[model samples]
Target: MKMNTKGILFVYTMPLVLLHESYGFFVPGYPTKHISVSPQGKLLSTRSIPSTTTKPSLYSPSTSTSSLALKSSASSDDVQSITATNKLDSILSKLTSAFPFFVLGSAILGLMKPSSLQWTNQGTLISWMLASVMCATGLTLEKKDFTNVLAKDFAAVPAGVLCQFLIMPLTAWAIGRTFLLPLPDYGPSLFLGIALVGCSPGGTASNLVSLIAKADVALSVLLTSCSTILAAGVTPLLVKVLVGNAIHVSGWTLCEATARVILLPVLMGMIVNAKLPNLASKVSRFTPFASVVLVSLICGGVVSQNSSMFLSSKALLPLIVGSVMMLHCVGFAMGYFVPKVGLKFSEVTSRTISIETGMQNSALAVVLARSMGASPVASLPGALSATVHSCLGSILAGYWHSKNKKGKEESSESNKKDFTDRPEDDYPELLI
Candidate 1:
């Protein structure tokens, strides 16, 4: 049921994603413009660049046919190569934008045929794949991004992280109890997996989602980076505190695993990005797409291995799905409302916080679940959480995008005398 419900969630979510992607991303209203300069040294918009209209003078000597032919062929080759590159990029963009659909399809396949992804269920394989995703995400960051968050003026960073760690752990526990997840003797409940997931850091995909939502992308990046770094210590402590009586969670073991699997690779990638930006830029383009693929595989592998759990009980699936989805929904609501209404943050920053808080690093949760020696079915919640939050995030982005647009329109109506038509001193605030 967890797998099937996730499939349904993705199926419903794809059209929303596609609708936004048509406007250039899993979002709308943010279009990029390309401009070029002519040989005569005039800047021109690509859409309106005029062709040469000057006629040749009668006295001019004729150029050689062979030289002219070679030049023409060379130019034609360059144009063809450029065209092919653009097409590849467009296709890749579409694939990444429609990522939830692909993950859903993979989940369906793995659930139907468990043996196909059975080989990928090993502990080492999960660890390596998760590490690679973390590394890929880190490659897109630089020293300045982390440093900016540490600046004294960035008060929201610490506050947001505090809320994430505090709110999510409690939320997960409450939701589990509400759903009546068994208390140990009933044969290895999902408490361990839910606890670990609740304790997870912000996902790497938060920044992308924030971008699509027109939120504060920089703030989201900082929150993800800070929470991930702190997870090495905080997650282990929280897990020990939450479900220590039922599950023997070794703080040292969990901490070591996190540092090795998550922190070290992230730092390594950051170093490379900082020291060798040229190489990082070229590699970063493909990292987002690769991370999406790795996430699908991890989710599929978990579902495939636990197919028996799904097959055994049709009734328990909804409980698991509802709990996981509710966890993220609570996280999003509290994360946003606390900052926006309670603390009086700007709309963009609040939206960013909400996304970063809600989108848990479920892949990390899946790895930790297996590493902790919980039941095979324990990883089910983490596997399905990814799909649930992605669907919710898309809906939020669309709603917020339309909201910001309407606000701008209303403001425009109010300020009919925009900039140039008004006195310079009277319109200073509207210049931008």
Candidate 2:
């Protein structure tokens, strides 16, 4: 229901903090040592050793974390500490690292407006960005990974895909019929909303989000890989079954469209990744920012064009809110449940499914909708999904983070209790 820029802002800003810390800047307790200059004010080549009698200087990680913490805690103009050089260096570092994402976002923004480029021209830009990202994904992969596609894990892939392609679509359809059908002319948009969820792939951020939530990282990756590989085929079929009539859909048409816009790019990336791993690696590094920029532009364009439909569609708000909530919940649940369905959802896999389901490829939805010449209303589902997913994912991940923290605390407390209650003489080995 909300556009969660918090993650994007963090993604854009964290590097700055890291850069500042790495550069011996304003960050406190960051191991900055003083160096004396010669009388001529030139830098001294030789460093003086401290007296042997001096105590060893303390360096604490807590102190390092706390020093950055201080910067965040300060009141306006209350500047309690920090060197001007360090501050400037820190600021500069942040700016430099964030520039690429900024520029990419700006370029996408400019391209989204019809005034910015011809219709034919836009395809090249989208293709370039997608191709670049795919290449990146390809570079990181090995033939060994695909082996899993044929192994026992293969069934899990379909199980997970079924959840995405089957469960999610059905849920959306039911919700639309029950809650959205009442609104006149909103029928197609509702179907469009369901299709948007049905057609999306696992989001790139799912692994990290799963980790943040303290879920299974490996399982998350596996499910994502399975679901994504199948998305190109499965997404369209699901859409056809759910909303074919409402949107004048044809299975072959959707399938071909999926192959071009989604499948081919992915396969090409895989091929490149297999053939030139180094090139794939280089491109992968930039894909995260590039993908974000692409999605942002696509969403912004949808919003801009459909501002009226978004406002007028009475079911718009509920549809957005309900769809996101349901999709996220279903993802998390299926990730958990399906693992238990004989695939053995490792602690990590459950976490992975939880994240993968929640973060769908909403950008693809927008691109697909726009490509189909669907109304801006049709694009609304994608835009709303994009806006809501990021925000909801963050909140969910934060919740999992908090739970993990609490679990650790409880375990610590239990350990302490046992230690305190034990007799040292009875179990002396425990003392070690």
Candidate 3:
């Protein structure tokens, strides 16, 4: 017997189709449907039926009528289930896409009702929420992603990490020293806050921006993971070296805390993704929304707790804002230019590095400041840093998204023109 192309394809894909159907049965909250395969191994419609419903008979004369009725009922149910699934997926996509808006809204709400999210100020709650966000970051990764980076693009990861650590902290220091000299009492606290923001790793929010900008998301993730792991040691050491005399910082304690809040949860998430990929994938769908909510709450908590202090700092507010803006602006500029000019990276890679470098993990900075008994005013910079970076990053995302869309349309039109201009004689004769 001779096998056709369809037969070969079916032979290869049948196992996957069957496995998917089997997995669907165990997926919670979603109704399982039976997938019908045609004789030629083409996929037919999946029909949703109650668990108690019997399978339709296969081409039998005696039960033909009953089988038809059963199939009809199952088909109706399948249509409804499919519609519901599509709607749910659409909602999730919208939520994920509007991540920046949600963060901004949460910050406004935090300012309006400071007391509502005040409970998030507790050290334990902040730690858990940050850990959850880190876990979500890890869940999106695969072992192969890391291995590919190690084998093929090792330099990119380190370059991004170096820019993150070097550019942000130094810029923070320079801006703080220049702008914050006038205020003697709260000046040191503000400087420490800015330094903490600089020393921290790239925020998980950068991953969302990278996705929107059509940048190198895998490289962004790798940079985030590596920088965060290094943060345990590097953050405290940098703080100590730069501002140790101004304020006492425990490098060992900060290192331990960072490892606990960031590394541990991320490792656990990676393990779960590796071992329970199905469950991880399901959970991963909601993690972006969850991260936004958690980050919002964290930012809200900081803003709420420091609302009074923020209002009171009218004299130093401009300087504080200016310093934070400068820190991020420098980060963004150097991040893109350095990679493009010095490292000779592509535009997309440079954009990704710029975003990852510019957006620091301000939440971690807030948590560390609070845990270490830094001035409450110091924590205010973190809240402001989060808001500023999100706004800047969102604008960048919109610009890149529009540019990519335009590029695609132009390329599509050019291809159409090329095809129209081609001579018919250039086409090969069809074998069939």
Candidate 4:
């Protein structure tokens, strides 16, 4: 299985590299000379004089008033444009920070009326939505961000990853055995799903959540990728040991899915950003809010599709819910305190580890669960996991964003200088 997975990784990687290079070669997103940067560093377009008219130099005495007037008008226009743009960013920032509410509402809506989100439950749409979210994450990143992770934050990778495999899987097995009442009568298969989720690597969504929370997004992405690569060996071994020989998952196939859903989309987004920085910056302004929406939809759609499975029993509801909820909360708590208190890392780095540890590849869990040869209902735990982890991560992001903003405001008032460097446009911070 390991060898096969390696083969698959090689096949997928070659094509992906070619495609990324092809895109960069064909669409080098070069900025035009007409593009101008305002004093505030905002991009603007300046029109050239007509061929029939000679453009007067600003130094010429004859056009001094005209130049002054033009400068005044242009400055006025720039102010209006910047004001409008900032206002839009402020609105998006509010909305993005409130995404926990949106996600929670979506989950509730999906549970109540599965038919409403039923159309979006298709496999292709789900993949595309997830890809789009990941792409948005990639757009926010630059090559330097990754290099920083490699240089500074590389050591933290194994520490946090250990928490994922060591803590979550064992905790999951214990919880699954304890909480579930065996509703569907396929005990091992349902338990297998639970175990699989715990053993799964850090979610691709972690990268997006890290960005939103103002955590170490570059570290989160690196951790996620590293964990995924390790999952090929660790996942199967953990399942075999914990669950005692369930139907095996194809690690190569898993890698292929991940490459399509995560690696490729992210690389493509990065390529676009590197090639067309101006275009990327313009598009990035809207991506954070868009990602929140798509994540809500994806989670809600998963719940909607699996609504009947877990909801079939009133008794089963709390059992499944309580189990998964407890598992993720433990994951989040342990993930947070371990890095925060034990390792004595910065708050931001610890938070990044917390998110990466908390969010699992539940979609991968769902796919593996389906092959368990148990009833389709066995996949419910993985589906429920998606709702639980995403909601938790979103809430964490929302809370952290608000707290970070409050701190910035206090600091700015004391120092009399707005120091909030709005990094990567995860959300726009307005300097009031």
Return the top candidate by TM-score.
1
Ranking by TM-score: 1, 3, 4, 2
Candidate 4 TM-score, true structure as reference: 0.67
lDDT score for candidate 2 against the true structure: 0.54
Please list all clashing residue pairs in model 1, or write none if there are none.
none
> Candidate 4 — number of clashing residue pairs?
0
Compared with the true structure, the alpha-carbon lDDT of candidate 4 equals: 0.65
Query: How do the residues 1-432 of candidate 1 rate in per-residue lDDT, one tens digit apiece?
Result: 344556555644664465454533244533222333434333332332121221111110111111121122247776666555545554455556555665665576567767767878864898899999888867877777767766733878987898889999999977765564564332245777777789996787677678678788778888998898899889989988988886678888889888888899889899898898778766766677788888888888898888877778766667778888889999999999999999998888889889988889998888888787777777888888877877777678767877776775566545443422544333211100
| lDDT digits (tens) for residues 312-356 of candidate 3 | 766565677778888888888899999999999989889999999
Residue-level lDDT tens digits of model 4 in 1-432? 022445434532443354344322211121222334444444333333332232111111111112221132346776666556655664565455444455556666667667767787564676787678767766766767657888997768888889889889988888877765354475665677788789886576676578667788778877886686577567767777786644454555545555666667777888898998877777887787787677667666666766775566567767777788888898988998998999898899899989988898776666555444345555667767876887788677767766676675555455322222323333222222
| Candidate 1 regions with alpha-carbon error over 4 angstroms | 1-25, 29-86, 148-153, 183-188, 407-432
All candidates: TM-score = 0.80, 0.63, 0.76, 0.67
CA lDDT of every candidate: 0.72, 0.54, 0.72, 0.65
Residue 173, candidate 3: alpha-carbon lDDT: 78
What's the CA RMSD for each of the models?
Answer: 10.2, 12.8, 16.0, 15.2
Query: Which digits, one per residue and each the tens of the lDDT, describe model 2 over residues 112-151?
Result: 3333223323543544444444444444556666565447
Clashing pairs in 3: none
